[model samples]
Target: MAIAKLDVVALDCPEPRKLADFYAALLGGALVDDEAENGWVVLSTPGGRLAFQESPGYRPPVWPSTEHGQQLHLDLTVEDLDRAEKEVLALGATALDTEDRSRSWRVYADPVGHPFCLCAG
Candidate 1:
């Protein structure tokens, strides 16, 4: 039996609302900002919920390296990798490992520098 259910995956960012907006746009969710809760932001999506917390001196993790660590990354599945890659890039995602187009997955960094992958399943 499960002891507890997962509520939401939270990420610490310099600006909570902005990060929440990015995910909401990408994942098709409603953005909820709770100013009373000290600038906490949440995105409610069909798959699950994601919360963003404010961290004044937040320094984004370094990709492809364990020095600063990746912290966490989201794997978003897509039907057409090419199409999705283009859209994400336009939305402020920077390609980290996209030289090999034949690969099943490509790594990218978000506007705030967190690494994520667009995977073809």
Candidate 2:
């Protein structure tokens, strides 16, 4: 049997609602559901569903620090790194680190502190 394509991408956060809102705006998605009783929130985007689950004891990743494990990251491809960086920063992403701006990729952290990268396409 062949496996079907992936349907959803889930993330753990201290506040699922807040994170859901951020992603909803970023992905141009709608808040399809928020099951507080189940500690989950889902955003429906054209590309796919992004789900956030509430974890009261959730500790965010301390990237560049081996003590904390990286939970997850999203790699986005853009036409122009500079323009994409500016847009994402306006959306509340923070600059984490970069090796070469002249190169094709840049790493950044979301508002809630998840690391992601933008690469040239």
lDDT of 2 by residue, 1-121 (tens): 7679787898888888878877776667788888856889889988789888888887777786778866778887788888888888888888887768887888887777888888899
Error of 2 at 108 (Å): 1.3
Q: Clash pairs of candidate 1? A: none
Q: Residue-wise lDDT of candidate 1 within 7-93, one digit each (tens)?
A: 999888888878887887788978764552596888899889999888888899998898989999999998999999999998888
The lDDT per prediction is 0.87, 0.81
Q: What local lDDT does model 2 show for residue 9?
A: 90
Error of 2 at 97 (Å): 1.8
Instruction: Tell me each candidate's TM-score.
Output: 0.93, 0.84
How well does model 1 score by local distance difference test?
A: 0.87
Compare the candidates by lDDT and give the number of the best one. 1
